[model samples]
Target: MNLSRPLLAAAAALLTLSLAACGSSKATAPGGATAEVTVRIPDPGNSGVLALGKKDGSLDRALAAVHAKVAWTGSAGPFAPAAQELNAGQLDFALGSITSAVTALATKPSFKLFAATDPDPVGEGILVKDGSPITSIQDLVGKKVAVNQGGTGEYLLLQALAKNGIAADQVQRVYLRPDQSAPVFSSGQVDAWATWSSYAVAALADSGAHFLATGPALGSDNYSVWAVRTVFADQHPDITKALYQYLHDGDVRAKADPAAFLNVFTDAGPLAVNGRSKQISVDFGRQNGVLSPIDDTVAARFDKVAAFYAAQKITKSQVDVRPDLLDITKLPGGSR
Candidate 1:
């Protein structure tokens, strides 16, 4: 579902204030140097990256180092709105799926990717009703499938269907918000739901949906990243570096003790899955001081995503994912 105009306008206004906050003297660098930066976090899921940032104080720590302010905002749709805010100079940075980041860069070349969060983007997966007759991906033919259109959820489902020789035209596609899809799945309106971690896991727990396919199975990189406006980066390079360093450190700490990360999830409210944190993977690594990119297998998964989107005619033009969009080397400790 598309976000209402009022919601979009409010987000835009909040973004403007956030940008203005960054421009104030509070965001200046050490020794009284002038620098302002604000990071806008889009709501993903209960245990997603944004939740992790809140739990571990990653944003606070990162902004503290740069003396910048963090304005966390809830998003209703995909990265399009957030990307628009960034392009309008209303935001300094955003955290979202790799596909979202790619879309942002494809349309607006002024942004640059700084870090990868999950190490493997292809790790995302899809779920179907448990104890149902739909055991294999091929069974999805002619079935009603729910997904968040133009987002990672949609991309993952498309990739899974293509891999199983199931054509998109053969199935009934239902596009809904992540929250809206959850209830519909619970009510048994949809045959299956394609989603990402935490939300997908939670939906399965609530609706008895079993894992049908994961990002890796469908050739996805299963990763997310941080993207920032180039102008913001150029004006506040030190803050950008410090933000990456702080987030990398938080990831390291979270991996060392996954349970500690759960506190953030608990504060946010009940997770999608009850007591399923133990079954989920929360490992994060840092190279040098910045978040690391996905390994070869993971990168291959992203390649498949680009191909699937192209095949579906999601975009009018070919997506050239190179140094311009997925630049992993530019991060402070990215080379490692």
Candidate 2:
């Protein structure tokens, strides 16, 4: 664990910069306590509450209750790289799926799940052309199916196969990121594309593609997850409480008027879809981003995801997600 002088100096400089970015504000808390009220959260420039909160200033306005402000950082998309950033103390908070979180855990990431949203299968599933012969899970046998490696796409695909008594190896798996898989799927290079969220919405909307097997139909336990740097959560419990409150309230508003909260619920990618696809994404957004504490039910779902990753040999070993979950109920905004 020894580092050269240059490396040590660089690390020290980075830490100093991070601290300066999150430097204490002059605001006083309820008990006349001077709170260090700056949270360094990611801005993936994509959809979701974080982006909406940032754009609308609701995230900052909400954090103001705790005398906190947000220091928006770089993108934390794709989860795995975000975990590395969290471990390196370069980021404070990020959003990810249960599948991403489980895989990130096996790498001994320095992040913890603090809040989560309910499972919404609206736009999660494998998409095939409208007239394709792949009508069911059974049709995937020996066919090339594109999926993001170690992500929701792969996890849902695997779960669907397992649920239908189909062997994982029976289907030809083509691992590709969303951007890369889009063209491949469009050109008929792949029989079906396993995806979730915006990508799924876009595919179905743009090409008249239909769900060959939906996430819920195939029994998906996917959940939207919020993760924070372990050190940040440990040091600023109040800040976490404020954040959870904001998310909860945001979800409430989003659900109440999904059309208005469309920007908050999803990014522009899916919103760009016209007609039924746009409506589908909006409907999915209604109850999708509801944030709640990582309670027993959430933990059980995450644990199941971990077990699946281990069984699929995606991880070296099974990771226990319970210990990494912060009991938000103990925080100030948790009860609501």
Candidate 3:
């Protein structure tokens, strides 16, 4: 994650040149300045609103106001690894849940929160086989529960345990990636699995695993969040602001017409959820997908979550994410 000054400069120059080469020189600014600029953003397998904007060219058009265009880059893995990409200067922007963001920040990664989704505790929880006798959160006391280390899965499990007045050490935490956890849980290697988003929906549909306890029922406040490379935000505040507004608009469109948003596609296929998991996906996004700019309220919520993670030893220590939040209104170009 460390880069010498010359190498960092070279990387930045290369990125600028690549963007300039792909941007449309014909685009103009109010002052007659050339608007040939492109901003690199991650296009992960399930891009959600990003796919809608990219497919409709709405994102590009939106960025045009800042004399910028979109440059979609393929990305992979969970938010923890994505944070590495941001720190390494491999991506300009990426999205993740607040749990993942806090975990990554605890390790001192170089990224900042720009926007966040309203926390929807639905679809996130611990799941067990439909007929399994482990019916309540208390039943998890001695059972093995699969969780993504220091990520959403772990956060959900710990939160549920705390809410039920159970200590985390009481349960056997089986840390695994989402893909890995799925098979293990299906094979009954783990007593339960704690997860969120499409993974949870797919698990219920494909494996018939019913929720032992859901986020809402457990009073969880896990949020869907977005992040930008710290250097990238500082260097291109205008593009950063434009990208945030574009995402907010796309979120609005998704909530307004879930079906249309689901229809958008990238090389991997449908942008949002479709097929058997469609309705649940729609419900989840509708109930929890509203985007809000990072403000005092949001910052305070994140601080609380960080403290919880630290208290439970899920994080090495509490991560103060307030310093990492980007206040777009305070930036020169961002004010517009």
User: What clash pairs does model 3 have?
Assistant: none
TM-score of each: 0.74, 0.83, 0.84
> Candidate 3's residue-wise lDDT over 1-336, tens digit each?
999999999999999977764422244568976755667777744447777677777776787777677777766457887788888888778888888898888767788888888676677888899999898888988999999988889988999988989988999999898879888999999999999866887777668888888888876667778888887676567777777777787788778776666645532443445556777777776776677788888788888889999999877788988878888666545322
Candidate 3 Cα RMSD after full superposition onto the native fold (Å): 7.5
lDDT of 1 at 321: 54
Q: Give the TM-score of candidate 3.
A: 0.84
lDDT of 3: 0.78
How many angstroms is residue 179 displaced in model 1 relative to the true structure, after the best TM-score fit?
A: 1.5
* Residues 156-247 of candidate 2: C-alpha lDDT, one tens digit per residue: 88988999899999998999987788889999999999998767777777777988877789778788888888877766666787787787
On lDDT, the leading prediction is: 2
- By descending TM-score, how would the candidates be arranged? 3, 2, 1
Residues 46-140 of candidate 1 have per-residue lDDT tens digits of 55334677666766765666666677666534566777877877766776676765555557466766677552442357778878788888888
Q: Name the runs in model 3 displaced over 4 angstroms.
A: 1-35, 44-47, 266-275, 332-336
**Cα lDDT over the full model 1:** 0.64
- Better lDDT candidate (1, 2): 2
Query: How displaced is residue 21 in candidate 1, in Å?
Result: 19
Report the alpha-carbon TM-score of model 2 versus the true structure: 0.83
